[model samples]
Target: MPHLNLTRALTAGVLTLVASQALAHGDVAPQAVDTTGLPAIEGDWLTENPYRAEKVGEETWQRAIEIGASGYNQNCARCHGLEVVSGGLAPDLRFLEAEEYGDEWYVERFREGYTQNGITKMPAFGELLGQEAAWAIRTYIEARPDEGALDDFAEELKAMRDQMEGYIADASGADTEALKTRLTEISAQIETASGAPVADSVAYRAANLIDGSAEAFKSASEVLTIGLSAAH
Candidate 1:
């Protein structure tokens, strides 16, 4: 009976070790990112991010962020950390610059992945994940605020929030174009102040006008809330 008990203990220990390793490297398998909601990129993958809010429109950019967040959580958070905050196992993706300088390296690394000796560090995700999902992840990463990136924009974000709220409160027969314009301006200011891509929450909401109705104002108001909270 003592011998039998020892055998069971050894088995249990092995099983536990295997389980932990699996959990740690579960992202090794390719996870599917749903890019059906996003606009399809034609031809081969572009070397740069085409989903920037200014380039692809805010709604599309927002959709990309949504998909990218899920993709990153599934495939990247294991090493990259949640919300792009790294715990030192990998580089903090949030600090990646939003301009071409960052884009060049990101595209290359994503396409080829990183391998040290015979060990694969980062798996190549371009072909399996597709450009839409990759770009979406990039968009999400670029939008993450660096340390102190939004400090100077706190008061401005608050002011923008107030303006959006006022619009929502008195939205009856409000000029949709004017509201969109104001929100767009605010988004630009956010990008300029942070020196990073505008957060999808702000970019998407600011650009979309839902038929000039109260619903539109409500949506814009919600965007403001999310953007302000993120900035703060």
Candidate 2:
């Protein structure tokens, strides 16, 4: 057999990590995509985005799914789920960025965290995986079928709302202009969701998603309308 080169070896290592992680988190399911007519995995794996490139057209989407699946399983399954679904213990990785934040938000959280509140368990992965590797992981998650572009946009909106709530809480003696900026962003989200007025319970849940006061709760409604509109 031809000897495995360093790149091949690294690719193998990456795949193995995803497989183990998915299995560990109970996210593993039978391959969803049909691989019967797909081409074999081959050649250098480099692409515009290394993480985004799976195995090329032979397997293409399937191969990408596998690599992403495995990588996510290894590094993220523990918290995000076997297949990016939520385990109820941690935020659902599939719908996270899809529902409340954008790629930049996800990237920032990957570097920093949900908030500086010190109450969340999410740890920054900047150290373990260089930015490229992190991006790869993100690509894998994004490739999964669970999240659509709208979902991605919605996720970003929610992140803004959550961030705004935090700002409102800490704004007592803080910068008024900053608060205004946050309000503007929040209003945008509300506009997006205007048609989808949430049920009282859902609205309440949405309200509680971020910590704040009665006044802040009122503000969240205005922002939610913008988010809802944006989503539509």
Candidate 3:
């Protein structure tokens, strides 16, 4: 058999095995989660079943937490983080708790995927992973700590933005010729400090928005802004 044909046959065989396993079991029960009443999961069971925390379960809570931890590592660790710290490709799942959004909010997000406010990177996993498994992952992740590094970076970036805004206001209000000279000098300084392509660094990118032609710059700014927002 040809290599391509062999590869295809192997793929089909593995999928067939998975399908058989799925079909062998009766459908898993849908878990009932009470969003309004509970505090965050803190590495302990909020209920008898930690994984399906809101539902009544025969399984011990520790066993459920274990299943949930394993399930999250398998399905979510890639884009989110190894320990729910966030890899910068997606929003930190920890935000679900710190932001004080409920389990139902997290569950609905996983099931429906976020589309409002122009955010769409998170695709719905409802079809691929059933409801119980999805909720289990959410329950597990709720206990992880906030990734502190990101908060530090956010503060630094905010300071930079404030500085940039001050410079812009000064330049805009002052003498036209002198303002142009100062902006040029500021742009050059930013380019040097950034250590990356001007277009890539946040400071230079924002500086470029100030200096650039209205039409071209605004479009680029929007794209970059949206990309950065999606990452967080």
Q: After superposition, how far is residue 89 of candidate 2 from its true place, in Å?
A: 1.8
TM-score of each: 0.61, 0.35, 0.36
What's every prediction's RMSD, in angstroms? 12.5, 18.3, 19.5
How would you encode candidate 3's per-residue C-alpha lDDT over 33-143 as one tens digit per residue?
322222244442222223442343423333444555677776566656666655444445554431223454566656666443353445666556555455556656654
Q: Candidate 2's error at 187, in angstroms?
A: 38
lDDT of 1 at 37: 84
TM-score of 3: 0.36
Predicted structure 3: lDDT: 0.43
Candidate order (TM-score) = 1, 3, 2
TM-score of 1: 0.61
Q: For residues 1-232, what per-residue lDDT tens digits would candidate 1 score against the true structure?
A: 3333224433543344344323333237769888888888889768778988899887787788888889889888887677676555665666565666567767876878765445566788878988888988988887765555456655754665565566665666566676567556654554421245565435445556444666666676676566657554
The model with the greatest lDDT is 1
Full-model lDDT for every candidate: 0.66, 0.43, 0.43
Considering summed lDDT, which 10 consecutive residues are worst modelled in model 2? Answer: 191-200
Residue 92 of model 3, lDDT score: 53
From the highest lDDT down, the ranking of the candidates is 1, 2, 3
Tell how far residue 156 is off in model 2, in angstroms. Answer: 36
lDDT (10s digit) by residue, model 2, range 124-200: 55555445455445555654332232353465456555555555546454343543455444333431111111111
